[model samples]
Structure formats: C-alpha cells, structure tokens
Target chain A: MISSIFPSKNFFCLNKLSVCSDSFHLNTSLFYNEYSVILTFLFIATILSVIIILFSYILAVQNPETEKLSTYECGFEPYEDARHTFDVKFYLVAILFIVFDIETMFLIPWTNVLGQLDLVGFWSMIDFMFELSIGYVYIYCIGALDIH
Target chain B: MIVLIICIVLKILVVVVPLLISVAYFTIAERKIMGIIQRRKGPNVIGFLGLLQPLADGLKLFVKETIFPSNSNIIIFLIAPMLTFILSLIGWAVLPLSKQIVLSDLNIGVLYLFATSSLSVYGIIMAGWSSNSKYPFLGALRSAAQMISYEVSIGFIIINVCICAGSFNLSFIVLAQNNVWFVVPLLPMFFIFCVSMLAETNRHPFDLPEAEAELVSGYNVEYSAMTFALFFLGEYANMLLMSAFVSILFLGGWLPLVNLFPFNYLPGSLWFSLKLVLGVIFFIVTRATLPRYRYDQLMYIGWKSFLPLSLGYLLLSVGILISFNWLPT
Candidate 1:
C-alpha cells in the first residue's frame, strides 16, 4: 500500500532526519525533506488519539442521568443561558495582542540576519523598537490594557 | 518505502512511548514531591512507590463513563481534548534528544514549538464555548486572555534566544551554548522565560483558568471520564515539553554540566535527561511553593512587566553584540 505512493527514490536516510541547517544553501527540496518526518509524526499522533478516544467511547459504561448532564454552575438549579454579554476588555486585549504580536514577528528575520548585517541593521531594529515602544506608551496612557 | 514507514513509526514510538511513560510517572512524581513539601506521604500504596499508579489511573479512565452535556455542541466538545492531546504530542517531534537523535530538526523548530503552543489556545476556547456551560465559558475566556498575554512576552524571549544563536534551528541553539550557556549571560531573560513558561503551561501562580475557588475546575469542569483524562494528559505533556524547551534554550540541551572529566564522560542524551528532570522538578517545586496570582495582577505582570523588560533586554543584548562584534556567525 505504502510502496505505490513513495516510489522508493532514496528514502529519507533511515538513520537521521535530514539536516536543514541555515548553513545549508537551502533549496526548497531540502526544506521539504526536513519536514517529511513531521508529517509522519502528525499522522501517527492523530490516529493514536482517535483510536484511544474511540476505545473509551466503546468500552465505557453508559449511565447518563438527567441532572448529571446539565450545565453545572455551582449546583444551583441554574440562571439564564451560559452566554451573556461580558467585559469588552478581553476583546480589547486580544486586539492589542494581534497588533504587537505582528511586530514581534517582524523582529524574527531582523534578529536572524543581525550577525550578517552591519551597524545599520542594529540601528534600524532599534528604530523599529522605538516606534513599537511609542505604540506601547500610547496604549498604556489610554488605559487600553488597564483592568480598572 | 515500507522500510521508511517502519523507520518513522519506530522513531515516533521511541520518543512518544518514553514521553507518555514519563508523563505518567511525572504525575506520581508531582504528588510525591508535593506530599513531601507539605509533609505527608503521597500515593505510596498503588505500586512500589506509586510507580504503577498512572497505569491504573489510565485503565480506570478508559472504563469510566464519559458524560456529554445535554446542552453542549457535541462535535466541538468531543474534539477539544483530542486537539489538546495532539498538539502536545506533535511538539515533541522537533526536540533534539541528542545532536544526532532528533525526530525532525526543522529549520523553524523554535517557531514550530511556538505555533503549536499558540494553537492550543483553540482547544480551550472550543471546549469552553462548546460545553455551553457558564463556568467552562468563564474559564475559557480567562484562559484565552491569559495565554495570549504571556505568549507575547515569551515570543520576545524566544526571539532573543534565536538571535543569540544566529539560527532558529533547535540543534544550533543548543550548540551555541557550548562555551557558556545562555542562562549565565542572558540571566534575566532566562528568569523571565521560566516565569512565562509557568504561565504558558497554565501552571501555578498563573493557573487562573483552573482556579478552583472561582471557576469550579475551569474549562474541564463539565468533562468526565476519559475526556477529562485527555485534558490531564495533555496538560502534563505540555509541562514536559516546556521543561524540555527551557533546557534547550538556556541550560544547553544535552550538554553535560561543566565539560570536565567526570561530567564530560556522560553521554549527551543522559545529560539532556538530567536537565529535563531538573526542569520538571522546577515545575513541581513552583507549584508546591506559590499560591495562585490574582487574575488582574497576572495580566499586569504579563503586559506591563515582562513585555517591556524582555523588549529592553532584547535591544540591550543586540546593541552589546553589535558594538562588541560578539554576534555568532
């Protein structure tokens, strides 16, 4: 079954995961080779979890009662439905996280190339951080992240 | 082709089996250590020192009744724990047991870990929303906000580590610490990283999601039997994963302590295990030691404190490296 799909062309060295170091003048193929093992890991993990969950589904005793299955909120009879309008602060925090998180993402490539780039690169990243701090300052003063 | 498939399966089993076993033992280890700290015996009767307790617990969960909330969205509810467990397992793929023994030393090993940990936000969100219960819903909300907040700081710390290493590869990150581990020079970042790791795993001082006093066991409040067990397993697995991450980034993954005669003689894999064990003990000790943080204080620490501290540290190190020409090639 597996043989037909993989057509045996120098299978991943049975000994080691393909080294995709930055030093390797990386082509796209080498990158794919590095990722092949992860696909296997994911497949095996999904299958294993499914089988385990299904096993419990099958072998487990079935004894569902009325109140036992009801949504629990401190054993009271219950109030209205679970969903209700709550604080908008969580939403605000999440929105701000997205903006700052993207700025964090931009720093990754900047950091990776830092050693190779000259003093200009360092100053450029410093400038970027300065702008980000300004945004942070604005958010702080506006009380966007304040709980009170 | 069959051989290749077999090899991959064997590789997965090698890492996964031991990992699952350790996660199992780690539960007992946690109980035993916490017991000693609090002055009592923990789980000693189950097996030779509670060694067989996890296996027994697994069997018990397998045969127990799984309760489905009548008011829940059944599909997403069922999928949540599965997602959590799967996310935890997949992160192990890129962790280098030793330099030669990683399952996948992907170029983006650091980001792969980060991304998977980030995706775990969904499992909690799904479980909370789908359970259709008030407590779980509240738990989920708290969890999402908390996770997203800490992750920002963690991302900065990781960026600093990656910059220091000059590569995102986990192996390269480990090897970069050959002369002096990051913990020594990057000491403050190391501390912040540890604190964030605790928050990231949703453990002590920051376990706001599962805060029993208010949230009533939190998102898994309504979950029972094997479904509940999946959440438990996933959480422990994540702790193990975070501990391993700390070792790789700061303590020097698979590096023996002090390259002198006695320490250098030990194999790299053994050194890695020792460091990983130390990390797990750190988790347990912190759990035993600290009380939970106030939710508002938690948010304050994540944003106002760790974020700027890490950001400043990032620029400080970057400036130092560039000025001194100390950057790794």
Candidate 2:
C-alpha cells in the first residue's frame, strides 16, 4: 500500500517516520554553508532596499491630485492612446535577433568540445555559418534589416 | 545552524555596506566629473567639497511625495523600481573581487551574471509600460530592443573569453589572463564590449531611450520620491556592475599589472578596485563627451556592426586556436 504511492526508492513517504528521518538526517553542512551565504546576502539586500524605500514612503508626503497624477504630454492632455501598435519593423528585427541569439547558445558547448572534433567540427560550424549567411543575406536583400 | 546563519549574515553586511556607500558616491563622482568637464564647480556646498551631497539628495528625494499616476497599473508601477534596484544589487553575489573575496563562488558564475543582466530589462520595461504614458511607453520599447540587440554581441564576446579561459567561472577567466590579458589579443572585442556596455547601461552616446530633450527622462518620467530614487540607485549600481565585468573579463580581474615585487605586494582586491574605478571614469567621460545617437543608428550599430563583428571574431578565434593547437585542455 505504501509502495503504491511512493514508486521510486528515492521517494520516502512521511508516514514511514524512521525511513524519512534517516534520509533527511544525511549531512548538509557543506552545501548548506555556501548556499546560506547567498541566502543571507539576498535576505539582507532585499531588507535594506525595502527598508529604505519603505522609510521614504512612510516619511514622505501623500498629496495625490488630479493634475499631479496626469500623464505629461508637454503639459497638454495626452491626445492618443499610449499603447498604440508599434511598427512591424521592430518585430522583423526582433525575430531575426532571436534566431541568431539562439545560434550563439548552440556555439558555446561546441567550443568546449573543439579539441575532440578538430577539423570536422570546424567545417561543420562553417556549414552552419553558410546556412546562417544565406538567411542573413535574404534579410538584407529584402530590407528587413533596414530600420525605417 | 543558527550560528552559521549569523556568520553568513555578517559576511554579507561587509560586501553590502561598501557597495551601498560606493553607489552613493558614484552619483557624486559623475556630477563632479561632468561639472569639471563643463568648466564649473559642482555640488561643493553640502559638506566640505560636497562630500555629503548624495546623502542630502537622498534625504530630499525620500521626503518628497510619490505621485501615483492616474489610470496607471498601480501595482506594477510600484514594483518596477524595486525590481530594478534589487536585480542590480544581486549580480554582485557571484562577482570575484579577489581570490579570497566573493559572496558565493558558483561554478556557473558567467551564466549567473548573464541571467541577472537579462532580467534587469524586465524592470525597465515594466516601469515604462506601467506608467500609462506615451513617452515612457516609447522609451520602454526602445530600451527593450536596444538591450536585446547588444546582449547578442555581449554574449558572444563573453563566450570568446570563456573559450580562452576554459571555464565558465569568472575567477578562472581572470587566472587565464595572468600571463597576458585578453585585452591585448582581443583588443577589438574589448572596444566592442565597452561600447555594448555603454548601451547596455543606457548611458550616452547611446542614450536615445532616455533622450531628455525628446523623451523627457524616458521610462522614469512618471516616477517620483523613493520610487525615483530606487531607479536612480539601480541604474548607478548596474553601471558599477558593468565596470566590474570589464575589469574581470579584459583587465585580468584582481591581479596586479605584473606579478612582480611591489606590484604583486598590492592586494588583488585593491587592483580590482583600481581597474573598476578607471572603467567607471571612462563611463562618465563618455557621458560627458559624446552626443546621443539617433534611435535607428543605435539599432544599426548593435545589429549590423557589433553583432557581425563579434560573431566573426568568435569564428576567427576558434580557427586560430585550432591551427596553433592553443585550445585550452
């Protein structure tokens, strides 16, 4: 019955008090020390930044006015919606960037293995680059790369 | 466990206090330097030589009112600055000040740094979008696009360094620079990295996103009081973080100019700080010296020039390393 819920040997049911206790009791000192330092820093940093901001918030004046909160449009009221649809050109460039950025991510691990692959790996990357160049050229020719 | 926790907290306080103090002084330094460049006295009235100006500024900003923009996304409006402030501070955790100093020496320190920098974009975007104002919305959009563009080249440059160092750990990158700094071989990459860093931090001449003449302070236009202060602090902290990155990647981290006699006698952290200060000065100088680029030109440099140059350099470095059999084992 107990085994049905906890299929993996690594997964111990809390109902099995002795088994759970032993596994949980295993040494955590080494891992704990380094992580604790990070945790402490994060905790303190968060607290410090929060305290300063909160202190200011508490001490500062709270005078909300219709004029004060209104969006600044050269002192005239905003004429159009702030969230108007942006240029499609930005999307085009962004998509192109995403493709190349992902390519860089792939290249990182390949660098680590360059010793073993030798000339074969180099040529493979060249092949990859050739394909990338084709897409880049296509983008250039179409003027997708051009910022209007 | 409790005692250990206390010890960790104390260790953190040591790094935090100095960092906070430096962030304050960085603003003062920028003003003073910019003032001198313009041939004027700057901020000298507060405390002997304007030493207390930042504190006074902090006080003034704190006591001022925080105006919640009508019809804005109130929750996100409030969260944006705090997000920026906290994200900027956290990147220092994995940074190696010296062989002995670091908050946590994570194995994937480079990735950690990348993650934090990338996440900082969200804070800016959130600030801009939440303001429900036209100028900030446009500013936010520009910043997002600009950051994403530059990050590509920055990523490649870092990977190039990691390839030479044979580890993702930043300290190892520094150690790799012991014999000859990466800057000497990767001089072009260094310049590209510096320019990209300038854009990444939204400093001039790449500061189109916040072109005050056009955008009226951009994303932080609607922010005020402590909220504004948080954004201000966060931006300066990020500038310092980027300076640290330049130092660590190209200038041999905390190592002395030469590991000989008097130079070697200087503490590694001291050398690290000296290099960082120089980088900060360069950042301030660039701000004073250059005119802001047009928005399109900013994108052109990032995508057309930097992206291709860094990518091509990566390929060339790989080719050379293979031919010379200099690939790190």
Candidate 3:
C-alpha cells in the first residue's frame, strides 16, 4: 500500500538496496520511503524541543515558593479546587460535533469515487445528507445548538 | 540505508530550518504590522528596527524560569507543547513548495493535513487538563470545543475542493487551479474557508478561548519559559501552515499570478511564498482591526453561519459539476 503511493523511480533503487541488505531493514525503509520525511520531521521536532527543554533546565532560574506555585484565581486564598464539575454543555456540543464530523469524513471517500459512483453516488450522498439533516434538526430542536 | 537516512535528514533540515526562521521573523512581522496599525513602534530596540527581536525574545524566554505548578501533572504538561510543535511541523511534510519541491507528497495530502490539524487540538486539551488549574482548564475546554466546531465546517469546505479537483492530492488540487484559482469561482467558499481558517488557528476575532480578560491566556496560562516558547512557536507555525493551505487550496499553490509580465518570471516557490505572505497579512490585518469575539458569538459563527453556508455550497457545486459533467477525472 505504501509502495503504491510513492512509486517514484528513486524507490526502486532504495527498495533494491534494502532487499540486498536485510529483510527487517527493507520493511522499515519501505515504510520510511513513503513517510520518511514526515517521520524525520517528528524526529527533528522532538529533538529540537528536547534541546530547548534541556537548555531551559540549565539556564532558567527556579525559585519555587508556595505562593508562586499556587493556582492563580486573582490574588485570592484557598477556594474550591480547579477540577470541579465541568459544564455538561461542552459534552453535548462535542457529541453533536462528532456526528457531523463523521458525516464530513464520509465526503472524502464519496468525492474520491464521485465520477465512478455517478448518479448513484450523488443520490446516495443526498440520502446520507438527508439523514444527517434530520440529526441536525433533532439537535437544533433540542436546543443542543443553543449556548448554555 | 545509511545514505537514505542521511538524505531524508537533509531534506527535513531544508524544510524545517527555513520554516523556523520564518516563524521567528513572522513574530516580528506581526508586531510591526500591529504597530503600524496601532500607530506605535512595535519593537525597534533589540536590533536595527528590532530585526533581531525574535532572537532576543527567544533568548529571554530560554533564560526565564519554568514554573511547574506543584499540583500539575508533570509529564503531560511538558508533553503538550512538544505535541503541538511536532504536529505543526509534520503537516509541512505533505505541502509542496513548488512543482519540484515537496517532502512526502502523499496521495492523500489534504487528508494528511486534516489529520495533523485535528490532532493539534489534543495538545491544547492536554495543556488545559494537565495544568491542574481552573483558568487553563477553561481555556482548554473552550479551545477543544472551538476547534471541533470549526473543523466540521473546514472538513466540508475541503470536501468541496476535492469534489471540484477530483483528487485528494494537494498538487493536483493546485494544478486544477492553474487556469483559474478556486477563489475566482468559489468565492463564498474562499470567504468561509478564510474565516474558518482564522477559527482553526485561534487567531484574533475568533480567539475566544484565549481571550485574556476571561481566560488569562487560555490553555497555556500556566506555561512559562521554554514550554511556553514551544506553544508560541507551534501557534505561529500553525498560522504559516494555514496560510500555505489557503495558497494551495485556493490561490493556486505555486502558479504565477498571471502568465504575463513579471508574474511568470518569478520562481514557483516565490509565488507560493508571496500568496502565503498575503494570507498571513490578512490574518494580521484582521487581528489589528477586529475585536475578539465573545465565546458564544464565535460558536454561532462557526456552526450557525459558516457550517451551513459551506455545506450548502458543497452541495451546490456538486450538483452543478455533475449536471455539466465538469467533475475532474
């Protein structure tokens, strides 16, 4: 699957070289070739961040007083803890978002096969959308869309 | 294997170094533009016209104390910024700077971008949750809700682009725009997309979660020094990423503005970068000009307005494309 996407001529040489060396090596490079740049990016980012973290550890002054480390709520003293009950409105909104987000995700595959799916594709999406609209209306009617 | 690893590392450096420098300089650009807009000198004391301000700022932050709240979850708190920074950088792997220049060039390039962006929300959430503080927690909740709200609309807009372009590949999306950028025909989408992009990046006007008055700097309020710097770099990098997205998806990635005069002579990356800068400038101008939205107002715009608008436009474009058989192969 990976090879199918990165079918560049360079892959051929990389593949041959890996095959000649070791099977385990070939597997990694095969995955690497398809996404090596992205992986390398992640690696570099992690390294860069680690360096900064270490740099700060060395240079940054640490004066850990009780007041300074305390949770900031204006300049007040002890109150209820920060981890109190969250508003349920956030949960309701998140659920609503997930439903539509999944529906939107469907559009990607649908659009990819659009021409091949043709009229059937079009109507199926319409039906899919119709159902989705019903869900939207249900949420709206329930005032889930309303800011609490 | 060794050579292959070396080559990959070199390529990563090539993309990242310039990106880091730009992220550094963009801080200056934002300050300068905001200064001009506000009739104030932003920061000219650090270097000639404050040319070295980002360096100075970075050094200052590097040397500042990192405050770890005694009550905070130590590991996750530290990891959150790193996650954000990494997620932002990884998106560039699929972006094409020019026809000849790209890092990975995945078949599902746009999807890769979408995935990375969606994942970035986690960083904010982690920062908020792990902080073990109320303000940061509230900020994180708001950010997560906001991102999800806008992402749905953004996904629909992207699907519309895919429907028109007929492929998920970013280069193909750009190539389809060669004759005419998508902004010309799909003007409403461009508007919705740009607005959603603002929300997506938590920029001004839509920066509800980070409203200083209410949230005291949102999810990263507890962060300081290098940890804070990582988050800062991540946000700016995401801004650049969104700018690149706009240029690629709507402005014709590396295409010359016009086929005539000086436009055609400039290199493709230059053209790409110019459009990107224009997008960044638009963000800056909006920041300078508009007041931040109330949290409720931001939600209303994302769901009630942009969501339906983009969804309708997606359906409309699909109907027109199929009827005219204009769907790309």
Give the TM-scores of the predictions, in the order they appear.
0.93, 0.91, 0.93
Off by over 4 Å in 2: A1-36, A116-118
Count of clashing residue pairs in every prediction:
0, 0, 0
Put down candidate 3 lDDT per residue, A10-75, tens digits, no spaces.
Answer: 322221242455556655654666576777778888898889888898877788899888777778
- lDDT per residue for candidate 2 within B222-293, as digits (tens), equals 999989998999999999999999999999999999989999998999999999999999999999999889
* DockQ of each candidate, alpha-carbon based: 0.42, 0.32, 0.42
Arranged by TM-score with the best first, the candidates are: 1, 3, 2
Model 1, B1-329: lDDT tens per residue? 88887988898899998998999999999999999999999888887888898899999889988889998999999999999999999999999999788998777789899999999999999999999888899899999999999999999999999888888889989989999999998999999999998988899989999998898898999898888988999999999999999999999999989989999988999999999999999999999999899999999999999999999998888878887898875
Which pairs of residues clash in candidate 2, taking residues 3 or more apart in a chain or in different chains? none
| Best-matching candidate per lDDT | 1
Q: Over the stretch A16-113, how does candidate 1's per-residue lDDT look in tens digits?
A: 23354433445455455567788888998888888888889888878899888888877687768887777899999899899879988888777666
Look at candidate 1 and give me any clashing residue pairs.
none
Evaluated with TM-score, which candidate comes out highest? 1
Interface RMSD of each: 3.4, 5.3, 3.4
Which regions of candidate 1 fall more than 4 Å away from where they truly are?
Answer: A1-28
Q: Is the docking of candidate 3 incorrect, acceptable, medium or high quality?
A: acceptable
Across residues A52-138, which tens digit of lDDT does each residue of candidate 2 receive?
Answer: 778887887788889998988887888776887887876776788789888877776665555546466668777897798788778
